[model samples]
Target chain A: MIVQTALLIGLVLFSVLAILLRDLLKSAISLAAASLFLGIIFFRMNAPYAGVFEISVVAGLITVLFILTIALTKAGDEVRESRVVNWVFPLFFIAFIIIDALVMKGLLRKIPALASGAETGTFGDVLWKGRTFDLVGQIAVILAGVFAVLALFRKGDKHD
Target chain B: MIILFVALPLVVAGILPLVGKVSRRVVPDLLANAALLFLLVYAAITGRHLIAGGPVLQQLSWFGEPVAIRLALDGFSLLMLLAIALVGLAACLFSIDYMEHYGAKANYYALFLVMIAGMNGLVLATDLFNVYLFMEVAAVASYALVAFGLGRDELEAAFKYLLLSVVATAFILISVAVIFGMTGSLDFAAVAKALQELNAGAAVGVASAFFLMGFGLKAALIPFHAWLPDAHPSAPAPISAVLSGLLIKVSGVYAMTRIFLNVFGLTPALSTVLMSLGALSMVVAAFLALGQKDMKRMLAYSSISQVGYVVLGIGIGTPLGIAGGLFHLFNHALAKGLLFLTSGSVQQATGTRDLDEMGGLAKRMPITAATNLVGALSIAGVPPLNGFWSKLIIIIALVQSGHPVFAVIAVLTSVLTLWYYLLMQRKAFFGKLNEKWAAVKEAPFWMTAATVFLALLCVGIGILFSSTVTTWIQPAADVLADGVHAVIGSWGF
Candidate 1:
C-alpha cells in the first residue's frame, strides 16, 4: 500500500512536470511515463484488461503520435518563454487541483471496496452480452480514425 | 434494419476507391449518395421504436462468444441518423462539382462515406466503448478532411485539430474505462442500471468530468474552441459544410446529450455546467466573429455561436427547452450547410474567401448571391426564415423555464448574429461590383444547383415550420423529453 501510494504520488508529480517542462520531446516522454504509471495503478486496482489497453494504446500509440507531431512540425526545440499568464495559469491550476484533491479523497478511499471482485466474468461477457452495439460503434470509430489519418497525408494534385 | 444503417456505408466506403478506379467518376458519386438516400428513407419509414416491441437481440456471435456487434435504433438514434443521412446526401451531391478541384476524388469520397458510417454507427450504438470508437472514427475523418488541401494553412490547422481531438478521445476513453470498471458492463442500459443501484460517489463525478471535457472539446465549447475556426475554414468547402453542419453536432452535442441524459442521468450541477458553457460560447463566439475579415472564418465563428444556442436549450433541462434545442439543431444544420456551400461557391468563383476583397457579387453570380442572402437572413433569425423560428422557440423555451435573463441574452445574441451575417452579405454581395470580378460568372451548373437546392430547403423548412415541426422536429424533441425514464422503461431490463 505504501509503495503504491508512493508510485501514485510520483505519477502525479511527473504529469505536472510533463505539462510544465520547456522541451516538447521531454514533455512527451514524461507523459508516456505518466501513462505507464497510470496503467500500473489500473492493474493494481484489478482492471488488468484496461491496464493493458492503457499502456499499449495510450502510453505506446498516442505517445508515438505526439512525438511524430512534434517531429513533423519541428516544434521540439521551440522554446516556450515564461510569461505572467503562464505563471498565473499554473497557480490557478494548482489551486483547482488542490480543491479537487480535497473533494476526491473520501471518494478515492471507497473505490477499492467498490471495484473489488468485480471482474468475475470475461471482458467479452460484459462487452458483448451487455453492450454489443457499442463494440460495433467502436469499430466504426477506428475505421474513421484510420481514414482521417490517410486523408491528411494524401497528395494534393488538382484533379479538376 | 439498424445494422444496415452502419453496414451499408462501411461496405461502400471500402469499395468506393476501387469503384473510382474503374469508373473514375459517376459510379462512386452515385453509389455514395444513393446509399445515404436509402438510409434516409429507411430511417423515415421505421420511425421510432418502442424498446420492448423492437427486435433488441439482433446479434451474430463472433469468436465463439455471443458478442456480435449490434445496433439498436431508438427515437434518439433515428433522429440523429436522419440528420446525418439528409445532410450527407446533399453534401455528396454538392461534392460532385465542388470536389472536382481537389484531386483523388475516389479517396475523398471514400473518407466521406466512412465519416457517414462512423456517425451512423455512433447514433445507433448502445455501448459505451463503441461510442468512443465511433467518435474517434468521425474525428479522424474530420482531421483529414480539414487538412485535405495539403497547403501550409490546411496542414497547420489539421495538426492543431488532431492534437486537441486526440486529447479529447483519450479523456473519453479513460472515462469509459472507469465506467466499465465501476459497473462491470459496457452497455449503456446496463451501466445506467449499475449507477442507479450503486452509490457511485467520486467515480461517477470523475467520469462525468472526463466526458464533459472530452465531448466539450469535440463540441468546441468556448475554451476548447481554438481549433474550430482554423479547422473549419481550412477544409474544402463541402467538408466545411459537413464539419460545421453535422460533424460537430453529432460527435459533440449529440454524444454529450445522450451520455448525460440517458446514461448518467442529468444532475443539477451538470445542468448548470452545461448552461454556463453554452452561455459562454454563445457570447464569446459572437464577439470573436464580429472581428473577423475572412468570410468563411466569420461563418466558422458563427457556427460556434449557433452551437451555443443548441447547448443552451438543452441545458435548460425542461421538456419544452429540450424540444427547442433539438429544433434549433435541425435549423442550424440546414442553414449552416447552405451558408458553407454558398461560401464555397463564392470562393471557387472569385478565388477568395476574404470579405474585404469581395463586392457586388450579386450581378455576376445571381443564384449564388441570392442563395447567400437567404442563408444569411435565415441564420440571422429574420422572420419567415427557418433560423428565426428555431431561435424563437429557444427564447420562448428559456422564458418558460424562468430564465428570462438568458432569453434576453439569447435575443441580444440573435441581433449580433444578424449583424455579422449581414456584414458578410454587405461586404461580399451587395456593395458596388468589384471590376476585378468581371470575369466571375455564376458557379458551374452543378454547384449552383446544389446551393440553390439547400437554400430552397432552408426557406421551405422555415416557411412551413409548423408542418416540419409536426413531422420531424417534434418527434426528435419527444425522444429527449422522454429522457432516462423513457430509455429505462422502453428497454424493459
Candidate 2:
C-alpha cells in the first residue's frame, strides 16, 4: 500500500508539473516521467501487458518522438498564454482533492469487486479474440494521423 | 453485412491517396462518392428490413473461426447510420468543386471517409471501451480536417480544439475505467445488468457526471462551447458543414443519449440535468448568434441553439419527446448542412464570410441564394418547412409533459432564431447588388446540386412529417423509451 501510494503521488505530481511548465522540452520530459510512474503502477497491479505498452510506447517511444520534434524545430516568437488557466486549474484541482477526500473513499468502498472475465487470458488471445474491434479503431486512428500529416505538410499548390 | 458500414469507408479511404496519384480529380471523386452512395443505399433501403424482426447482431467468423468483432444495428443505430451516409454524400459532392482551389483532394476525401467510418463504428459498437476508441478515431480525423487549409487562424483553431478535446476524452476514459472496475465488463448488456444488481448509486453518479461533461464538450453545450465557433468557421466549407451538421450530433448527442438512456437508465436527476443544459444552451447560443457578423460563425452558434432543442425534447423522457428530439436532429442535419454548403458558395464567390460585406448575391448566384433561403427558413421554424414540424413537436411535447415554462422558452427561442436568420438573409442575400460582387458567378454544378438536394428534402419531409415520423423516428424513440431494458434484455449476445 505504501509503495503504491508513493507511485501514484509521483504520477500525479509529474503530470501537474507537465502542465504547469512553460518550456516544451521540460513539459515533454515531465510527461514521460509521469508515464513511467504510471507504467510501474500498472506492473505492480499485475497487468503486465498494459505495463509493457505504457513503458515502451508512451514513456520511451513517444518521449523520443516529442524530443526529436522539439529538436528539429526552432522556437518562434514568445507566445503568452492566458492568465485564466493559472488560477482556474489549481482551484479546480484543490476542489477535486477535497471531494476525493470527502466522498470517493466511501463511494469506492460501496462498489462490488466484480470477477475478471475475458481478461483472464493470454495477451495474444486478449488482443485478437477478446478485443478485436479495438484493433480496427486503432487502425483508423493511425490512418487519420498519417493522412493529417500528409495533408498538413503537403506542397503548397493552388493553395499557394 | 453491418460491418460494411464501417469497413467499406475505411477500405476506400485506405486506397484513395494511392489512387489520387494516378488520377487526382475524377477517380478520387468518383470513388469516394461511390462508397458513400453504396452506404446510403444500404442504410436507407436494406437497413429497416434487416431490423424489422429485431436488433440484428453481427459476429464475424474469419477463416472459419469466430472473432470478437461484434456489431449491432437496431432502430437507433440505423437512424444514425442513415444520417451519416446521407450527409457524408452531400458534403463529399460539395467538396468535388469547392475543394478544387485547395489541393490534395484525395487526402481530404480519405480523412472524411475515415471520420465517417469512425462514427458508424461508434454507433454500432456494443461496449463502453469501443465507444471511447471510436470517438477518438473520429476526433483525430476531425482535428486534421479542421486544419487542412493550414492557415494561421486554421492552425490555431485546430490546436485549441485539440487541447479541449483531449481533456474531454480523458474524463471519458476515467469514467470508463471506473465503470469497468465496478462491473467487470465493458459490454453494454453486461454492464447494465451488473449496475442494476449492484445499485451503487454514488459511484454510478460520478461516472455519469464525467460522461456528461465529456459529451457536453463534444456537443459544445453552453459552458463547454468556446472551441466550436472558432473551429467550425476555420475549416473548409464542406468540413464546416459536416462538423456542425453531423459530427457534433454523432459524437456528442448520440453517444450520450445511448449511454444514459439505454445502458445506465436515465434517472430523474439526470433528466433534469439534461433539460437544464438544453434550455440554457438554447437561450444563450441564440442570443450570442444574433450579434455575429461572420456568416459561418452565426450558423455555428445556431447549431448549438438547435442542438439544445434536440436535447431538451429528449430529456423530457417521454416517447413523444424522444421522437420530437430525433426528428429535429434529422431536420437540423439536413438544413444546417445545406446552409453551410451555401455559405461556402457565398464565401468562395465573395472571398469573405462577413455578412456585412455581402449583398444581392442573388443576382450572381441565384441558386445558392434561393437554397440558402430555404435552409435559413427551415432552421428558423418557418411554416411548411421540416424545422417547423420538429420544433412544433418538441414544444408540444414539453407542454404535454407539464413543463409549460420550458415549452414557453422553446417557443421564444424559436422566435429569436427566426430574427437572426432573417438578419442573416437580409444582410447577405436580399439587398441591392453590391458592386464588389458584380462579377461573382454561380457555384459549380456539384455544390449547387448538393444544396438543392438537401433543400428539397427539407420541404418534402415537412409535408410528409407524419409518415416520416411513423417510419423512422418512432422506432428510435421506442428503443430509448425502453430505457435500460433496451440493452439489458434485447442486446445480450
User: Which candidate leads the pack in TM-score?
Assistant: 2
Candidate 2 lDDT by residue in tens digits, B1-493:
9999989999999999999999989999999999999999999999999999989988988999999999999999988998898888999999999999899999999999999999999999999999999999999999999999899999999999999999899989988988998888999999999989887898899899999999999999988889999999999999999999998999999999999999999999999999999999999999999999999999999999999999999999999999999999999999999999999999999999999999888888999999999999999999899999999999999999999999999999999999999999999998899999889999999999999989998999989999989888899999999999989888887
DockQ of each: 0.41, 0.70
Q: After the best TM-score superposition of candidate 2, give how far the Cα of residue A7 lies from its true spot, in angstroms.
A: 1.2
Docking class of 1: acceptable
Query: Worst lDDT window (10 residues) for model 2 chain B?
Result: B194-203
Instruction: Report the C-alpha lDDT of model 1 over B1-493, residue by residue, as the tens digit.
Output: 4678778988888888778768867888789878888987877766544332532535556677765565566656766877787778778888888888787777788888888888887787777778887887777777777877888999999899999999888999988878877887777777887788888667888889999999989989988899899999989998898889898999899999988998788888988899889988999999999999998999999999989999999988887788778888888887888889899999999999999999999999999989988888988899899889988988998899888999999999999989998889899998899999999988887788778878888889888989888777766666667666655655433
Q: Which interface RMSD does candidate 1 score?
A: 3.3
Model 2 local distance difference test score: 0.93
Q: Candidate 2 lDDT, tens digit per residue, A14-119?
A: 8876887777888899999999999999888889889999999999999999999988894765646557658866786678567766776777577667556434
Clash tally for model 2: 0
- TM-scores, all models, native as reference: 0.87, 0.96
